[model samples]
Structure formats: structure tokens, C-alpha cells
Target: MTKQQQDEPPILPEEAVADDSASIGGSSTSESQASLRSSILDYRRENGRTYHRMSDGKYAFPNDAREQERLDTVNYVWMLTLDGDFCLCPKNDISAKRVLDIGTGTGVWALDYADAHPETSVQGVDLSPIQSTYVPPNCYFEVDDLEKEWTWSTPFDFIFCRDMNGSFADWEGVIAQAYKNLEPGGYLEIQDSIWPPVCDDGTLKEDSALYKWSHLLIEACDIIGRPINQTNKRPAMMEAAGFEEIKTTRVRFPISPWPKDQKLKEVGTANQVQLVHGLEALTLGLFTRVLDWTKEEAMVMCLEVRKDLKNLKIHAYWNGYVVYGRKPLSSEDK
Candidate 1:
């Protein structure tokens, strides 16, 4: 989920707006009839105005300086958690083959994969069409909505999903779909952070701000049927979705750089840097008007909010569960 766009400059309003690059009074409501999508979208919302959309279905970092900082934090910190081993094996595990990078934000991971494995072909998909249109001969981008149905021509040897905590509604559905799309003996990897659940002094309490914040966010998503708080039981869900040989790893990152090991300490610092700026955006980005918080209160609370990320001993982390399985090989291989 790492990005390099301008931090959103406004707050938010619900509902999609018209593509004014087109004619007026012309069928804004008709999803089927829309002629073209905007190349550089800059639209107005209740909070003020917003710019080109990102994958989460809204123009985040909208209008507020603090919000952009928060998002940049989340994006960069999560990138740190992408351990090297996670990227290393798939190449050797399978012969040079086609791959899928689900939710390929900014197309960083996909590009990295392409660079590492020259023989493999990679396809990256996102809602915003924000990926660079120009790519290696083996890499391509498609603006497909994963929430709906996905139809790819070829079965893939590897599929990757990451940092989609704020974007997807049907986590299991998407996982199952990945299972369906994978070739037998192929592999799939999913990585996401556990949002809003804080570990206080290495213990997660029910009432901590992280916990409370998480609950509110879940409720907000429940209202719209697009909730994203499903982190704890991902392994079992994957099994149910038909993935086998699932491997789950929980890496507890310091919310704000507080690890004893030098290597891990660097990770903590990265998480902390992101934490300082992500507080306002994560707290109010979706919940303010949608959840209705006063602008003054959100700003005030955020000052103290990021401090929580610094309690290194507090053991705050966005747990990444990478559960992958092999599609059953055919009788011939067996």
C-alpha cells in the first residue's frame, strides 16, 4: 500500500461525483452508460474538495494536512514488514510462470517481482488505475474491481495480496476467489495489518484506544457492508476457502520505533515515523462525517493519539498473516 502521490488536501463526503471532463446533466448515475473516467480527478466533497481517487473507494488525505501524514506513515511502515523471504521463495518454488499481484498499489511490489524473476509474467490490478501504464514487457495493469467478479484468461502460479486492511469488504470471498483462480500446485500470499487493536504493555486490553478505535471503525464499515477488521482467524478462513498448507506469521512491530534488537529497532522506527502522521488520517479519515466527529476534536485527539504509537514496550503491532496453499496438482503430476 505504499504510495507517492500528494497527501490528500481535504476531508471527505460520501457518494461518488460526476466525471466533469464529460458533459453536464448527462447520466452521472448510470454506471453502465458512463463514457469515460477522469485521468486526474479533482472533485468537491462536504469537507471541501478532493483529488484523484485511490483504491479504498475515497479520496483520502482530503483537505487535512494531518491526514496525509498518517497515510504516508501506514504506507511506508507496512513496506518494512515485507520480509525478504516472503519475496524470495516463490520464484524458486515454481518454474518461471505467470503471477498475479492483487491490490498492487503504486505497483511497487509487482515491479519488484518482475525485476527479480525475469522469466515470470505479472499482472497487477487495482480500482484507481493509478498504476504506471508503462511497464516491463512481462508486467501489465488492469483496472478491475476485485469486489465484483474477476475473469482472467490464464491460471496463475502465484497470487499476492497485501495491506488491503482499509479497502476490501469480503476478505473471505476474495481469498476464495484467489483459490478458485489459482492453478493446481500454485501459491497465494495475503498480508495485512491488524488495525485499531493495541497491545498495552504487551497485553491487549478491550478498552485501549486501539481496541476502541478498531470497534468504531468496524461499526462504521458494518453500516455500509464493507467492514475490514477481520484479522484474527485468517488461517481458518483460508482453510475454509480451500487453501492448504497454510503458514501464519505474526510480526509485532512497534507503533513508534521501540525494539531492543537493532534490526527490529529500525523496523520500530519506521512504524513510528508512519504512526506520527497516520494518527489523524486513520482516526478521522472515514469516521468523522461518516462517523461524525468534530474537526476540532479530531485534531486535538490526534496530538495525543500518536503518542500511543511510541510506547514501544506497549507492543503495538499490525500483525501480518501470510497464509498460502498449493492448489491440488492433477493426477498426472501425482
Candidate 2:
């Protein structure tokens, strides 16, 4: 990272704050709410999908309503897959005084955590301002790019991030920033799905459109210096960042409803819905902008990929990894 990159400022202004009346259930709208909506409308549009114009092309996916719905569905499915568990870290049972959630899409996890632990102060930051206007008293939302320098005033006891694929060009920089911002013995948890599904039964053919889509998207991301398949390498990166007692857990997430087990079937069913709903939002920008595909051509390819996502006989699943580590209690221990 260059010196300028290391010193990059937050995405939002220092005085920017979420509107308290903008919560999902609230109907009141303030000046801040109108400002937030106008800011979101300023995003660049391509093929009916919106991209973050302020991010300087660091992130590829849209931040529009359709994309936000897909993100919420993903969070819902993850909660169901984990049997309602929020954090898988061993220290989850401990009451954290301060928590920071990076890339907090819609602020769902942060709100839930704050509601569950009223004593904790939770701060959620993201590149988009789509979070609810009404949030808990103990929970707050900010618009900031996590790839830049963190200007938080205090260290956090726990830091959590999810589904941050294709958002950061330097994974090690993010890990190192987390290490620097965490209090001693503080824990960091990251959850993400490995891009490009794997099939063990040979049902997902090499010529399948889903396989082609993955290859094209991965290639596009690689050309942009951000690889989406970094979930498996997170443990090593965390270890290199001076974190201790690192742990990683992997879960198989089916692309369709092909699993015989009830839980797996449910997960696959939910995933099928998520993939189908998000196919365009996930690929339209990348394919059209980076891969030189026309909008119609991209839509046709996405349709083919959606068909494969709903095919029950495919028996394909992506690896979802949850990795966590703790900062040492003392400098000597590190």
C-alpha cells in the first residue's frame, strides 16, 4: 500500500450521521433522511444496477434496493444456517463492551447484536447509506470505506465482517488494520462464501453456464486486483497480522435443493432464492464494465446461470468459511 492509500480518509464526512427516524418501521423523514436518499441516488448506473461512484471502482456490486434486498436475504440465510447463532468465535459468550461491524449491510447484524446486548455500544460502517434511519440507542451507523485508514476514537472488544468479497484490494491491510484497532484479547470474526462452487458428484458439468459465469467473474476480479476467492486464505493472513489462537470453520452451502439432509436442503433452498434474486446484481456491473459484455449479453448469461442455480440434480455447493482470531493480551505475548 502506498503512503496515500494508507492515509485515505473515511468515505463519509465527519459530521454525517444516519437519520434516527429512517428505521424500517418508522415513517417519519427528516432532512438527514432526504440527504441520505439523495446521496444514494448519486451512484453511477449501468445495466439497471448501481455502483458506488465514490469508491473509485474498488467495489463492483450495486448498492441499490434490489441489491440491498439480496444482501438482507443472505444475512437471513446465514443466521438460519448457524441455527440463529451470530458469532461463532469461542468468546461469543462473553459480553463485549464495544463492537465494530465492518461492511455492515443494512445494519441487520449490528442492530440485532445491540438489541441482544443492550449494555454494548455497537458501530456499523459501510460504503453505502442504505441502513435504516431508526436504530437502537446503543447502535449507530456510519458510511465509511473499510479499505482506508480507520479513524475510530476507541478500540473495540469485537470486530465482525461478512460477505466482503471483492471489496478490498489488500486483504492483509484489512487484517492489519483490525489488529491495530482491537483491544488486547479482542476477537475478530469474518464470514464469507468462497466464490465458484465445487461439486463432488460430477453432476455440475464443466460446460455448465454456472461454471462459465464463475470463471468469467473471477477473471474480471483478478484483472482489477481483487480476487473473490480469498475466503480460504483468511486464516493465514490473520496469523500473519499477529493474531493468536486463530480458528476456521467451513460449511457446505448447496447451490440448489439437492441435499438429502433436511438442514442442508433448507440451506440449499434459501441459497437458490438468494442466487436467483442476486444473479443480475452480482454480475451485471462486472460483466458489462470489466468483461466488455453488452447489457443484453450479460442478462442472457445471467439467465443461464440462474437456471443452473435452480437445478436440483447439480449437487453443487460453495464453501462458506468463518474465521476468527484474538489479539494477545500483552505485547510480550504477541
Candidate 3:
């Protein structure tokens, strides 16, 4: 989940380059590439739609009832980062001093953080005040926007942001805000995925339907002046925002359980199961109105996308880049 300009998160230190070179290895990806992908982002789908209910986007979570299972499922895979050091440290190691969770949808991560680390204070904020009212003593959920000037008035040692992709209009500003709000030597960790670029053996044809269909998101973000392309810009932007010691890693799940890597296959299949339930709101609400695709078409093609997820040998993967860096201690900066 992420702020605006999410979905296609910016580049990690790897997977792509800031040069916007349009070429990788000996083969250039731009010239004669036949693919219409943007230089800003590689092939990916955007996720994180929890804020739609409050705003004018597609679907709304917690309208009448909360899809607690769906929200928690999306959060479980990345629980690795839910520690003090990793940023989700509630009910985890208490080494972390403080944390701020941006776009905290269900307040699940924040509550978990607070529970795990009773000594640490954690705050979760969203455009919608739809999260559970019950929370850990160390955790609190509020209604706030990461982009509209942070009002917390307190600096934190770690900033946790998820699933605000559709709600952010200025991602760089958000990152800069994280930099500003972080205590020196604090950490920032993020996880998100909703863009789609399937690679069956890396041979999914350029003309493949997914290429065109997934672009609906690209177009929609463009119209809104936010972007699905924000994923690829993290490392550089973080560096520019004045973070250091940056490291980036990628995790990919096949759309289904067809990968040779049984773990990824399992992950992909599990993720796909979740997607089956969330796909309509993700595409129809997130992209349809802007892209003008009908509910029937989205329903049909997304099902195909689900089928592709489990196609064992497709080598198809959607990647999430995990990166963390310390806010430079002012003395260290000198």
C-alpha cells in the first residue's frame, strides 16, 4: 500500500537504472523493443486501494463491513519487515524506538507494531477513519494525509508506508516528508504491488494482451498526475531526499502456483487467491473509469490474468523491491 504515484513504485537500486537509459545489458529496451512500457517504470501492476471509499476513486473498503481477511493477507507476506529494525516491530523486537505508518489502511500493521513493542510509540493514518477503533496502548490510528503537510509534529525513527498509491499526488514530496520526519539514523521500509507485467519464460510476446491491458493503470495514473511508476524511483529519490546506505531487494510471486521455485510458486498462488477477491475493485475502481474499460471486460481479462498466475512454467512474476536506508545523522552528513 502506498501514497499517491504508487502502483508502479520507483526503481530500486537494481531491476532498473535512474539514467532512464531505455536499455539494459547489450540490448536496448527502448529502441526496436516493440514494448510500449514507460521509461519511468518497468512492467508491474499497482495495488493498495483502501482509500477509495473516502475519495472519488473506484471501490471502498470498510463501506459496510471490513474485508479484514483481504487486508491482513496483503500485509502478512511482508511481515518480515514488521519489526523495529524492519519497521513493523510491534509484537516484534523492541529495539526500534518509534515508527510512523503512512496510509495505514486497516491499522493492522500499526496495531501489530504497537502490541509487539509496548515501549515504542506507533501511529497509523489514513484518509478514511475506517480502521478498527480498538488498538494497542502504544499504537494509535488517525485520519491524516501524508501529502497534505504532516501534522504529527513528532519525528520518528522508522516510517512505515503502505497502500496509499491511489491517494498520493506527489510521491517525491512524501518521500521527502519521510526524510524530514525521521530521526537521524532512522529507517524507512515500504512494500507494495498492483501493476502487472507477466513474463512467461520472459517470452510473453510484446503483443500479448497483458501488455495492453495493464497499461490502463499507467494511463490512469498519468491522467491523475500521480503514477504507477513510483516504485522504480525509490532508491534515487531516497538518496535525493537525503537518506544513505541504501540497499534494495526484490521479491516476486508468480500469478499462480506454476513456478519452478516452489516458494515463489506458492507465494504467487497465494497472492493470486487474494487477487481473485480484490481484482475487480483494483482494476474497475482503480483504472476502469479513467481507462473506460467495462466491468465485464475487466472481469473476463483479470480472470485470464489469474490463470496466467498459476501457469507453472510461465516464469511470470510481479516484483516488489524492498529497500531501507538510514536518515543520515547530521554529524555524519558533515
Candidate 4:
């Protein structure tokens, strides 16, 4: 096999240990248990969409099953794009001792990584407590905000974050924390897709519903002080955070089933499914809570966007960027 192919981690068939009954903490009534209880009770619901109350509505998306399905589909699509590789950091020969997934979502990535590398300890942290209880023994999930101060006791060998488009208010702070919490020579990999798909042809006009939706979403995120489109700036942010040996790869992610090529056609089909399924869930809160749009108005806009998504003539695609960097071995190396 080629070196690049060899670098990919093999897909393991072993089943991950399940622990559905596990909660945040034990039954003890200690201070730590009380704190955990408070965190668990911090979940809030708005118009059927669940959100993390700890951050006080900092994260825009819902934590319901619809969002979870979208996330899992996106993750699977990414794996398919990478030929089953979970990460692109060149650490094939070395087994990461400790790994951290910043926005763990359902903790599927952490569980898969832990299952692949049984010797590694994988910790997935998120603002919501939606992660599955049954997970690999080596994998653990914690409820915490990534923008807040990190409380990790030890440095990790690798860190991974994906699909966190509108979650972080301060991306720089999150990268800085990752750098600080990573062991020297550790690697950090970030995978995110650019918003507002680009269309080279004239099929996607500025007046199109897709274009209008993208504009509104971008404007809303900008007003909130957490810009959603950071695909281009991530590499520079990592460099500024003192990470070295940085590398970036950009892939054209299809937005609809308009591509003639077989691989891209498959990607486009998956994108269409995700976008159609998540159109309402993705923008309902953003429109109502941020843009002051009524629920009916938001749904009308969503319907228009969905129609545009299914239009094969648009030929639109989002740029997916994978950026990875390593911590310097010593302070002088900086």
C-alpha cells in the first residue's frame, strides 16, 4: 500500500463496550455530584429544540435527535470521503496515548477512536449531555463548554474537532486552549465545511433562495459575534496559537446531486439528504431567536431553501478544510 493509505487507521470490527445506565457521576452526595447534577439540570428547551443552558444559548443548534442524525450522517460522509480514515494527522506509526474531542456531539467519533486504539484514552467534551451512555471502556464523555477555561489535569497526545460551525464565540481562545492542553509534539486536527456553497456557473443567482438563506445565516452569526464561516482562517489561527508544522487540505464538498463524477455524485447525494433533513432544524432557532423571524416565516424560508437544494442545476459545493498542526517540542522551538 502507498504510504498515505498505510497511514490510515484500520477499521476495527470489535464492538465497543456499552454503558447506557451510566450518568455524569456516582450516587454520592458530595460537592462534585451536586455540581454534576446542576450541569445536567441546565438543559433547556425552546420550541421543541433542546439547548445547553450552561452557556446561556451560546450554541445555536438544537441538541435533539434530528440534529444528532445530521451529525452522524456528516461524520459518516467525512469518513467515506477520507476512505474510512477517522483523522488525517500523520500519526500512523504512533498510538496516541490520550485524545480529546472538543465538540464531541454524540461521542461517536470518540467511541470509534477508542475502539480502534484500545490503548488510547479518549475524552469527549461538549456543552450538552447528549452522548450515549454505552461507549468503549477507554472512552469518556464530559459536559462542559469549550469556550470556558479548560480543566484537563494532563496534556493530551492528540485533539480532534469537527463540524463545529456556529458553536464557538471565540475560536482563537479554543485553539489557544488546545495548544496549552496538548503535549509537546502532540497534533491537533480540525475539520469544518465552509458555509454558503460556491457555484462557478451562473445557475445559482444572488436572488436564489439558497443565496438568501446563506446571507441571512451569515449575517445573523456575525451579529452574534461568532462568525460561522471560518474555513480559511483556521490554519492561521492555529499558527498564531504557537502550533508548528501546520498543514491544510481543502476538498470540494458537493451540495447536491449535480456532479457527473461517481464519487462526487455520491457525496452530493449525501449532502442533499443532510441539508433537506436539517433545513428547519438548522435555521429555525437562528431565525426566530437571532433574526426576530416568526416560526411560520422561518419555515417558509426553509421550504424555499429545500427546493433550491433539490435543484440539480445549481451545481454548488462547500469547501471542506482539514487543518492539522503540532505543538513544538520545546519553548525555544517557537
Best by TM-score: 4
Model 2 stretches astray by more than 4 angstroms:
1-41, 332-334
Q: How would the candidate models be sorted by TM-score, starting from the highest?
A: 4, 2, 1, 3
Higher TM-score: candidate 2 or 3?
A: 2
**Residue-wise lDDT of candidate 1 within 208-255, one digit each (tens)?**
555566677777766656556666567777778766777776555655
TM-scores vs. true structure, each candidate: 0.74, 0.87, 0.73, 0.89
Per-residue CA lDDT of candidate 4, range 1-334, in tens?
2253245432221132112212443355568667766766666888777777766788888888889999888887788677688888965347799999988988888888889899998889887777887877888887777887887778898999998888888888899989998999999999998777776556678999999998899988888888878768999999999999999887766777677666777777887898899997789888998899998999999999999888777767777889999999884322
> Would you list the C-alpha lDDT of every candidate in the order shown?
0.59, 0.80, 0.58, 0.80
| Candidate 4 lDDT trough over 10 residues, lowest sum | 12-21
- Kindly list the per-residue Cα lDDT of model 3 for residues 210-319, writing each as its tens digit: 55556776677778676665675777888888888887766564555555444554565566676666655556554455666666787787777555444444444566
Number of residue pairs clashing in candidate 1, backbone atoms closer than 3 angstroms, sequence gap of 3 or more or interchain = 17
Off by over 4 Å in 3: 1-68, 80-94, 206-209, 331-334
Clash totals for all candidate models = 17, 4, 46, 1
lDDT of 1: 0.59
